[model samples]
Target chain A: MTIPIDVETKHRIVVVLLWLAALVALAVLAFIIAVVLWNGLPAVTLSFLLESPRDMGRAGGIFPMVVSTVAVTLLAVIVAAPLGVGTAIYLTEYTSETALTRVIRFGAECLAGVPSIIFGLFGFIFFVIQLGMGWSVLSGGLTLAVMILPTVMRTAEEAIRAVPESFREASFSTGASRWQTVTQVVLPSALPGIVTGVILGVGRGVGETAAVIFTAGSSLHIPTSIFSPARTMAVHFYILAREGISMRHAYGTAAVLVILILAINTAANWLMLRFQAKQG
Target chain B: MTVARREKAIERALLVSALSAVSMLALIAAFILIEGAPVMLRHGISSFLAGTRWAPTKGSFGILPMIVASVVVTLGAMVIAVPLGLSCAVFLAEIAPRRAANFLRPAIQLLAGIPSVVYGFVGILFLVPLIRENLGGPGLSVLAAVVILGVMVLPTLIGIAEDAIEAVPRTYKEGALALGCTHAQAIRRVILPAARGGIIAAVILAMGRAVGETMAVIMVIGNAAIIPCSVLDPARTLTSNIALEMGYAAGDHQKALFATGVVLFAFIMVLNSIATMRIVRGRR
Candidate 1:
């Protein structure tokens, strides 16, 4: 097809427009991070990190929220990683292109597209009300695990598939069983990629607000057990901002959350790049 | 156990684990439907969907306004995000130097990782006041939601669209170039057409994400439960409707929220199917 504009001029204009688009995306990221950090970094003193909130989060620190964030994130990764990695192993190592694999893949793809709010609803009904787990870390963690399961499975599948068939063959050439070959050879080669997936899941679980809020129950107090309702930093930030309670505290919480997410994302990207480099 | 028996057991265990995604999807669908479907059945799907008022306290749960809000906001966001996201994807995949692409890729990933709540917080502080003063009406209108959600969906759109663009066969570009086409002409005519399926799939997936977002929408949507006459008018989404009320809602109110979830889930499933079809067709 021919264009009204000259090709060279159109190419130049389009390239400039594309560059501007990328700049806008970058500016958005920078603006969010800079604004949050500028408003929030002052609130992140040692006392702020160590002390519990007082006066409904208008005063004091986010000690309880920190503990809750760590506990919930850990629990989610613990539950999701094995199941996700195992699913990857099954799909890549034990199976070929088949109806069963396609069904499983479809299920995963659909799950990935399901919104966090739906996951929250499911967890609220199933784990919280039906199972009597209530709004607690357990409910939140389990819900998050389900939400991030697809990420883990997809990453692990990619990693496992990248492993050379010759490695498995070499292991099988020994007296090793199929299971042994997979466990020793394939999994070892895929470890970095699997770790990247787990880290990505961790970042997602940590940054989650909607699913965590309903299932975890945004309590300000430090959680005593898995069953104890607790507030994540993201939920805390949402509550503070929404209620117009404490803009300062909200910024502080947001800053901390942003910092954590940035660190986690950077780590995951680094690991993925390193893995890709190794594979290449 | 014999070695073969052990291997079989291990394979069985892995297979069971592999079934986790399917079972989880099944359980989620069943639970949401079980809790939400009764309300839809009781009220009749037509009245439930077509009704405008959402006074849960008074037992009226028409969600037409919220549905309209969701669709309008999603469409608005998509209008803003798709062109910019597609342009960025094309630039990165076809135009950018290798080092620049490598650096920007992670930055985009990090952008995606920024929690929705943070975006909402920023929106409340910045977009709300800016719109309130300049655009008139409530600052937390569908416009605010459109801007935030448009930004939120960018990473997903760009990432997938970039992959799609990159996946186009090199021979197609070469063939176009050999026809005395300029670099831009080769891409616009040959590469982009070949990448149409993936780009469409990406857009649909991003649309799903925008539709499902909650905390961010709630924070800035003004939550009036009214049909927006204009982009500047305050509106509520199905997601914000559920999230706002689920905390204090009980009895029928609670079920109504679940029913809202059912609607959202059904909408998302439709989007997912369309995107999946596009992806599958692209593969062929």
Candidate 2:
């Protein structure tokens, strides 16, 4: 028989391997953030943040793209938040497990799985062509609204379900209607979680490219209205890098995007932690 | 009576809002099929599905090469990602101290929050050049896409897989330890087997992410339409084909691009079905 390693030694070796794996996973994140910031941070400046692009994005700042990003993301959240919360309310408060609920859940799950590019295609045909919205902020925002809907719904559902059942019962014994109980008690307790979900949806909308590029129409011009075709920061970065327009500009844009996303994610995580602490 | 009437109206409104997801799904499928299906029918399904040539201007539209490239790059990514993700997940669930796991969990979700465009930019700056200098192929190849995607899918894989592993009852581990098993051996024999269904589900879900990935894959994959003979060779994927060509395409070319989207949607639906089924089975 082959010489066998002692159990304690073997266990130590495995633990070391697992530690290395976790370290490697974390390292990848650290390295990507470090590399992007290292190269891009110097390029970010006051003018770079405030001025519009010039020379087909070879020079000047990303002010227009910034505005477009905010406009589109805000519109998406405005459209999606109520619908998502309403869906969550319906699922958790108004119904129990049934065929209808199952169908709704299945539809939401399938929607979640559909890829962004397909959403692009659907938006292109339905909103851009059939509905005659064209490639504009309106179409792009609507498309992203649909894209982030499942995420919003799922998060809201979890938050609502986490509210104690006894709270609902107390409202009922006080002769509150189901709708009154949900609106007054359930939603208030779930507000932090719902806001977290909305923030997450905003984060996804901010960074989306493929779907936005098709529906939003990547114009360098600042959007004056929802009908205006304007580029977002993500789409602008994609075009610059892919077309090899200007590496410096691309890096600066990337830095901004990375920092913005990091902030949103941190905010969401903090809110979630606070919510959990309160629940406990 | 008035309160009851008001309550019923509110319930109806909420129910209508709840139907939005289902309606959106139906509309997306119907619209994509309406735009894409005709082109597929015109080309004959087999030619589009199995044809090798894909010159839109020349009236040739075959997507076999892109299909093959998507499958190969996705599978290659899974190969690189699965072991790394599983070990990290295991570390989080079992080996890591509570303080460390708490800090690290959010850190990984941050990884997912990084935009795909940024991932592509990073790949272009570092990974592509690295591959070119060392690996001998054009830096933008299937290999580059695989490496980038492997890292991209890690968050999804680790998050779900860790949940699955942690869901196994503590008694299973205690039983193994009581029977004179080492910690590593007990994990290998009992904990892992108990978590098998969830682990498999995690893999399938990650596979879906890898396949649906667009911006990063487009940047690094060189986007050549031909099938690659090796991972080092350049290739285009189904999503990229749509993204790259949809801008200037007209008429049938546009429809062909939509047809590509149809194919991608179908592939993802299949993956989603399998993952959901696995999750359901695991729960049972």
Candidate 3:
């Protein structure tokens, strides 16, 4: 069974295989991004961005969908940011490592693992139906808030934990209360990380499709209030593509979505890099 | 107000906010169970789990086909992704220069951040047509789901595997290299075995992701509630079934969808816990 293979040849083969694997991964990412941009960019016009849809998304723009997407994302951030930051603060600053902390961490992991469709189901039943929010921006935003809660909390916790212990000790030595130390000293230092988490949450909210579909009714018109039903760009693209309604509009919507997500992700990455630099 | 009282109040408030996360998890589970369990109990758990048919209109709620489809798709995705991901991880951790890794790492993270819907869109536009033209079948088969999910899970698998591989002490490789082993030989003989636990953990986590993926799978899996005879055969997954039907399902049918969710939830939980355990063990 001991065939004498040349070590040089074997090393060369392994290196080639590793290069091929990396190339394949890179190729796939490139192809997908290129295809989306190629097919989508032409459809994205000023009119498409500014005007409302006409004739069930076949003839006009996606202004309403854009508005709805922003509204829902803003609402989700409003609801999730404070709660997530507070939870992170509690975990990092207030609480000792205990069974309760373990349970909470476990819960966050479980939440993170739950599928988007399940969240949609829960949101439809609980927020839209049980709470009488009906398929509206509020219901959709609330559902998204729950879905993104773990991401924000985990990131914020890491950020808060990354704050130097010496900083806290300095504050304590000044006889400042724990609350004051966190709010005035630690939070200011950790703000970049927290903002990065929120931006990432916004990215999720924007790109999310399944979870928002049922809870946020796919209304054609722009939503005027939180109670008003509306469609997000992702849901709009899904409906258009799935129903074979309008590929042009779908591509246009997809292009906008892709751009929005890329922008948010780039900003988040920049903030994270800056935060890391500051830490170093 | 006294500073001590104010500090206590703030601590309590923060504690309550933190506990809300736990409560939310409990609430989701409780509601899903309460809504889903009745139908299962009424229909007999065995019948619900083991039956082949899943016609909600006809009042049959068996999910065997969906379960099989889910497992098949997840396994197929893992089979395709793990090698590529692992090799990529190895290249990044062991072979590539630091400059290459610095450039490649963000690219991989960006891949992860691209929404699932975009993946689904790409699948419908490209993969489905390609499959239909070349491989036959309805194009939107488990093959399409596998391909899309395979790509979707790559960043996850690669990132975790890279971390695990990098976590292997530099001394291990140094020792092997000192013995005159080639870089590849040392990595194959020493580094891989040292990082096996973490790689397995990565695979398990990716499996959880593949099993739970919905929107993309729904777009490409054809949504047929039948056991697939081959990868090219159209079939429905548990997540897809719930999503495709929850819109119009009523009464028993709706309850059946929730029951499906319960199954999916349980599957994810088991995979997640196993992955978590492996990761914890690997860290130690």
Candidate 4:
């Protein structure tokens, strides 16, 4: 109903001002990106990112952190995928229209609205303290697992729902058990979206701060096992910058985090496209 | 057959197992409160609410100004971000070309992915300097937090508000147009009101983000534990307070941080409930 900013008359000045503000935003976004890219890329050459954080500071690079991030993220996905997919499958395919399903759907939606800090608090108590995981990678990963459950469940549900009822009908006609049809047919159809959710959730945890900081000790020691204290790159950046580290170093770290996020997003998009093409 | 009846029970069991994700939120809440309650009970109500000095080492347990700062900063962010984010949403959904809208959508997503620390870095690097240069005096004030928080919440608000605006029925727009109403008029009159519930929910959610935000606000707010007399003054926020001091806090000081978290939790619970209410009503 509204005119595009360009063509709208009688408000040229307003549009100009809006663009100016947007440009400023863009500029800020760009400068930070550039700083991170400029610093991290050269410093994080293949070996540095590939290497372990067993040596010294500033120069040691973030190998263990990177490994832990990947390891924990994978572990998280592993934990979330079955339960999330099962829940999603039940919601979209198996369950009949009912109050319970409706309530569950609403709960899943609101789960994303909970602040990450609160999740950190939960993780600190449940995984880190009560469970005696004690700031281990296992606790961090499991906490992230629960945090990402709703994401995976919702996306998996949508993807499963997109598999037409005909598929189920045909499988039933072919004498396939409900579980067989669901596991074999519905899962393959929904795999792409489920994978996307996993990717997105990993991206979220990788960038997370308030939640992971408390549960995952910000120790820079290279984790000997999943239970060892470790620092995520995001948390590293927070601690370093908070302690008044030089802007260049902070910018470099931020840049590394951004690049990783961008890379994750790109892969997810590619997966989406490939999946859509297959559907077509 | 007994076998078939057992199979039915098994199906019901599977259903129960799958739907247990719904309980996870309550579980999370309960777990946090359980860990946090001891500290809250020990500190009593007065010092947690009425005091202001936050030295964990000295055993000073005042959090009044930090609580106020959190509220003020969140309010400032909401004041600036809500309108701007709404306008951006309007621009995308109602104003922009399809191509531009599609392009901007992903850019907003990109914005969302950039870490909060990066935003903090940008606040320190760019926003602080810009505010300092133009506005004069000590840089990185509450205004800076507002500016950064406004921009940070832009993508989230825009994405949600766009959905709300887009959810406005096509028939309403057509009817408005048929009545000699301009496209802009239809949007301003019908679409906005129709989408009011969702917009409010989106705004509330963004407010939540602003309140919980630590790294970015901590980066720019200067972390002064004073009652900010104006938006131009530096102030400490609740999340920033925790992140700053939780490092070395021992005993009651650490407990105070937990109490602060309890306060923040109560704040978020209120916001989330409001958001949930609006969202539920809109669905109805």
Best by DockQ: 1
Clash number by candidate, in order: 0, 0, 0, 4
TM-score of chain B of 1: 0.99
Q: Which docking category, incorrect, acceptable, medium or high, applies to candidate 3?
A: medium
User: Candidate 1 lDDT, tens digit per residue, B9-79?
Assistant: 99999999999999999999999999999998998899889999889999899999999999999999999
Worst 10 residues of 3 chain A by lDDT: A247-256
All models: lDDT? Answer: 0.93, 0.93, 0.91, 0.76
lDDT of 2 by residue, B1-284 (tens): 69989999989999999999999999998888888999999999999999999999999999999999999999999998999999989999999999999988999888888999888889988999999999889999999999999999998899889989999999999999999998899989999999998999899889999999899999999999998999889999999999998889999999999999889988988998888778767777
Q: How well docked is model 1, in DockQ terms? A: 0.87
For each candidate, what TM-score against the reference?
0.98, 0.98, 0.97, 0.90
iRMSD for every model: 0.7, 1.0, 1.4, 3.1
- List DockQ for all candidates: 0.87, 0.82, 0.71, 0.43
Q: Estimate how well candidate 2 is docked, as a DockQ score.
A: 0.82
Q: Write the candidate numbers in order of decreasing DockQ.
A: 1, 2, 3, 4
User: Candidate 4 regions off by >4 Å?
Assistant: A1-31, A51-56, A246-248, A273-280, B1-20
Range of the 10 consecutive residues with the lowest summed lDDT in candidate 2 chain B: B275-284
